[model samples]
Target chain A: MLNIVILGAGNVATHLFKAFETSESAKVIQVYNHRLESLSFFKNKTEVCNNINNLKDADLYLICLKDDVIEDYASQLKYKNTMIAHTSGSFPLLQNIEQSGVFYPLQSFSKFAELDYKNIPFCLESNTKSGIQLLKKLAKEVSKQVFEIDSKQRQTLHLAAVFVNNFSNHLYTIAEDICKKEDIPFDILKALILETANKIQTQSPKLAQTGPAVRQDFKTIDRHLSQISDEQIRRIYQLFTNSIIKKYE
Target chain B: MLNIVILGAGNVATHLFKAFETSESAKVIQVYNHRLESLSFFKNKTEVCNNINNLKDADLYLICLKDDVIEDYASQLKYKNTMIAHTSGSFPLLQNIEQSGVFYPLQSFSKFAELDYKNIPFCLESNTKSGIQLLKKLAKEVSKQVFEIDSKQRQTLHLAAVFVNNFSNHLYTIAEDICKKEDIPFDILKALILETANKIQTQSPKLAQTGPAVRQDFKTIDRHLSQISDEQIRRIYQLFTNSIIKKYE
Candidate 1:
């Protein structure tokens, strides 16, 4: 079995631990976090360490800590025999570590959310060929989709992810707000949302775009702006309208 | 049988004709368009008429024309005995038509695409109660999800749809652009996109929001913006970031 030590007790850590528990080739040797409260959940499942000094030897030390603390922890991390990897989209791999690599899973993690690894794309990179080869085995054991991506490419993936996931979700939030103000059930728009997403499956988003912005209907645009009472939403509407018009033009 | 005459040869017109062909009560007796070439597809399926004057008598005259031409067509339409309705999300019902209503299907329609009306939300509005009752039966025949929405609420739904469908699709377009630049397959983000939409089923979009912008991570925000070379997309990123920050605050 491939021994693993997971650092940090956030959403990613919790989900990783759960997935590792099911994998036949891997066992989490320990899970370490600075906070005792976060470490409590891992107590019965595996060895839980609150102090960084008590981290044990494992095949891989997967760091799932906050972005700010990742470099600090990695710089102070004292394991010489284990391969060190971080699960960050935007962070640079520590060159100071002897066998450093990245094992980034591209998906939003919620503490209580049920995660299915089949569809999630895992991006892996390592300084040494052996590190990448080992990481690949572990990745395939956990996920069906894996991509060999460097740090720069991984960073770009994260940025693009922010657009597709974060920004798109915010647009839904804005739609929900509009529905709330009009006392219309936001549920009505869910079908439209699914259809819009389904369109992207076979078509480029460029050709798939349709609205007043695409048709250049200024009258309808003005009418929509008039109904929007919130200043922020109105500005967002105008900005997107301008961009869309520019795109179609 | 409810004989129907459909005007226009666009995406919406084509889809409606197909759906109507499957309905037992409604049979498209005639498909009318000013352009003979646009009416070629309906030649064997139904009677195709190029001239408006040759329009056959039908129970309903469904005008699925362009928004700008909708009022013009309704005003000049000679079918006074029939219930004249236009499938427009934002256009007003033609007041001159004695029997007028709206048969707006709240979903994006594309040419050469399979459309299942089961999940599509049909927003219906009528000038008369009798008209609504008749339209409700027809709508139920076409789609399972039907809403009797007024002009104001219909307009609001259209606006919200702009955010969820149009704007969210644009965000996907932006992500595609980013991935294209990095030589990464846009397909990698599809699962994440689906997950984002699925989250709205059990949770509000506000509660589902995640990212550097949602977390107010200035370091990551700065990193993302610096990498985005395209001036317009960068501006969009900053604007959305500001909106998200204001939202969570």
Candidate 2:
């Protein structure tokens, strides 16, 4: 069985800990965090540590901290023979280390949100062949989809994720705001929102694109713009309309 | 069974035709389009007419034409003891007519795309009480969801729909473009996209929001912006980041 020490008690770390707790081939032997209060969730469940120097010896040290502190945190880990992996999409594969790899789960996570890690694509990268093999094995235990993505590709994926997940959700928020202004139920647009996301799963987003902007229906666009009172929202609307027109027309 | 004559053969028209075809309470008696080529799909299955004057008498006359021509087309149709309704999100309920109503389906329709009308909300509006009852009955035949939305509210829903569907799909296209440029398979982000959409079905978009912009991770945001070579995309990234920060911070 693989003994894994999960560092940081954030969304990714807590999720990873639970994912491995049920796995027969792997187990989270210890969880480390700088704040003792943050590690309260994993206290009774596993070995929790507040200090980085007090990390338990394990086969793999998984750093699931913030991107700003990942490299520094990884540097502080003192291990005799262990693979140190950081779960970050933007960060590159660590160099100048004996066993270093990246194990990034390509999905957004909230502390309270329930996630199905089975379908989540675990992007694995390693300097050594053994490190890659170990990550692949650990990833397969929790997920069905696994990919050998390099740092460059992973970074690109992260940007793309922001566009699809973050930007798209922001659009939904805008829609909700518009509905709230007119006393219209935002639930009406929920089905269309879900369908739009589902459509691109099979059809290309370029071909699946629809609306006044793609059709260049300036009349409707003008009408929509005139109704919006917010200057910021109007600017966003115009920018997106112009962008869509530039792409198609 | 209530007979219906559908005017204009477009995406909305085709989908509505297919939806009502299996409906037990409603049957499409004839489909009319100015262009004979466009009516080819409805040939042999139902009565097809090329001229508006040749439209057969029915209980309901449903106009499924372009937004620009819906008013003109509805004005041209001459019928007795029949209700008239147009399927448009942006267009207001037909006025100055004896029996006028709106049977707008609050979802984007593609001619070839398979659709499940069961959950699709049908926004209904009419001038008379009987007109509304008829529309509600016909709408309930194919869809489980039916709402008596006014012209003002329907217009607001249309604007909201543009944001959730069209604007969101454009974001997906941009993400695909970024992935293609980096030789990264866009399929890797599909699961994340679906999950983001599914997340909002229960949680509010504001609460569900994540990533650099929401977290105000300027360091990662700057890194992402520096990597992008496209000026328009960079501007969009910066604008969205600012918008998100404005909302969260």
DockQ for the candidates, in order: 0.78, 0.84
Top candidate (DockQ): 2
What's model 2's lDDT at A109? Answer: 88
In model 1, how large is the Cα lDDT of residue A217?
87
Error of 1 at A32 (Å): 2.4
Q: Encode model 2's per-residue lDDT on A145-213: one tens digit a residue.
A: 999999998999999899999999999999999999988888888889989988999999999999999
Residues A1-249 of candidate 1 have per-residue lDDT tens digits of: 899999998899998888778899999999998888878889999999888888887889999988888888887774555689999998987787889999998988878878798778889999999999989998888889999998998899999999989999999999999898889999899888888888898889999999999989899899999999999889889989998999889
Q: Candidate 2: how large is its RMSD?
A: 1.5
lDDT of each: 0.89, 0.90
**Model 1 bad stretches (over 4 Å):** none
Please, what is the TM-score per model?
Answer: 0.95, 0.97
TM-scores, chain A, per candidate: 0.95, 0.97
Q: Who wins the lDDT comparison?
A: 2
TM-score of model number 2 = 0.97
Give the Å error, residue B151, model 1.
Answer: 1.1
Alpha-carbon DockQ of candidate 1? 0.78
lDDT tens string, model 1, B1-249? 988899998988999888887899988999999999998889988899988778888888999998888888887674556689999998876687788999999988889879888778889988888889878999899899999998889899999999999999999998999999989889888878888888887888899999998889999999999999999899889989999999899
Whose TM-score is greatest here?
2
Q: Give per-residue lDDT, candidate 1, residue A184.
A: 93
